[model samples]
Target: MAIELKEYIVAFIDLLGFSAMVQHDCERPKKEHRYIKVLYTIHLKTKELKKTIIGLEITQFSDSVVLAIPYSQENYKKVVDVISNYQYDLLNDGILCRGGASYGKHFSTEDFLFSNGMIDAYKIESTIALTPRVIISKELIDLVYPASELSKNEHLILESDGLYFINYMKNGNADDSWKAICKAIPDELSENPSIRSKHIWLIDYYNHQFPESKRKDNHRFVSPDA
Candidate 1:
């Protein structure tokens, strides 16, 4: 069959600490079976997301998941919503992830995946998205929502470094997920020091985006125990 290349918005997501999650379980006593729960959780959550979200094609392997959608305003919006929700859901389950979304030419199918779109998304996710946030490529932003319109968009925030990341806390009710992510930072900092700086950046961004007033119950930070 001939390869069919087309424009697509691709998202590449990596589960943070996945290797550690596996290693920790591997080193445990064989009879303890602690890793079963982690494996089950990942399976359940991915299955749930796939069933819940539509209009996108997904390919998942080990700690990475790739989602692709045909380029369109509606499709792009769905991509953003699915990715944002997936990130938040994972955080609530004590698993953090980072990813990148880009738009370009690509070929993807149930059994095969290849393209510059995938390459761009992977590069951004591995290099740029060091935190538990899905960084949107400027190429995607320009293709989906031009700069003039994005300036007034509340769901997306342009950081000081000029990269645009989704403000998952937007629309008001996502506060709980936002708080959960903040609460997870300290624990992740110790577990994964390589991304410590990115975690700090995420915390700073969260504080700036949701100030004391915007925060519920007059709390600046949620208790890790809570």
Candidate 2:
């Protein structure tokens, strides 16, 4: 089989408590099988996602997963669908994932230009400690064109790169309690006036895999007022 080189949108999804999961297993090696089960499930889901979204490739390293997609709105939309479906399965099976994605030109070669998109995604994921949510780049939001507009739940808040806050539609509306708990942050930051760009992200709690305390990663980002 020959694989051709192409452009891609790279996404780095770091699970918040994945290190804790590994550490917990390290401290108690007897329960390693359970962690293996989780990893296996992730592997299966990644494969399925790849099959569903053409030009998508994924690999997992211990507690985190990296997904790459061909740079196109259609493919990115499918990627989002896969993420949403994965979230559904996690919720039904009692698991939560703190995920983040950035869309930009990526290559299949050794040399590539690394930017703040990846760092920002990780930072946002870290900042949401104790919460289950997916943080995405502003560049992505401009590309998503859903057939039917979804309703924004009270738990959802949209914050731009310049730190301007906007109330936007939520892709999924599962629980009212979840909405209330997630949407408690005020819109806008008066303290930091040196922000730029129009990028924003969606944050919420998954309630299935983890408690709210697991998402903080010591990153700096203005979060909703608790």
| Tens-digit lDDT string for candidate 2 (140-168) | 55455332332342222343233211122
The C-alpha RMSD in Å for every predicted model, in order, reads 5.3, 10.3
* lDDT (Cα atoms) of all candidates against the true structure: 0.75, 0.49
Flag regions of model 2 displaced more than 4 Å: 1-7, 29-33, 109-120, 123-130, 143-226
List model 1 lDDT by residue over 10-79, tens digit each: 8899988788778887888877655558667777777666665565778889889888877888888877
Most accurate candidate by lDDT: 1
After the best TM-score superposition of candidate 2, give how far the Cα of residue 206 lies from its true spot, in angstroms: 7.3
Candidate 1 backbone overlaps, count: 0
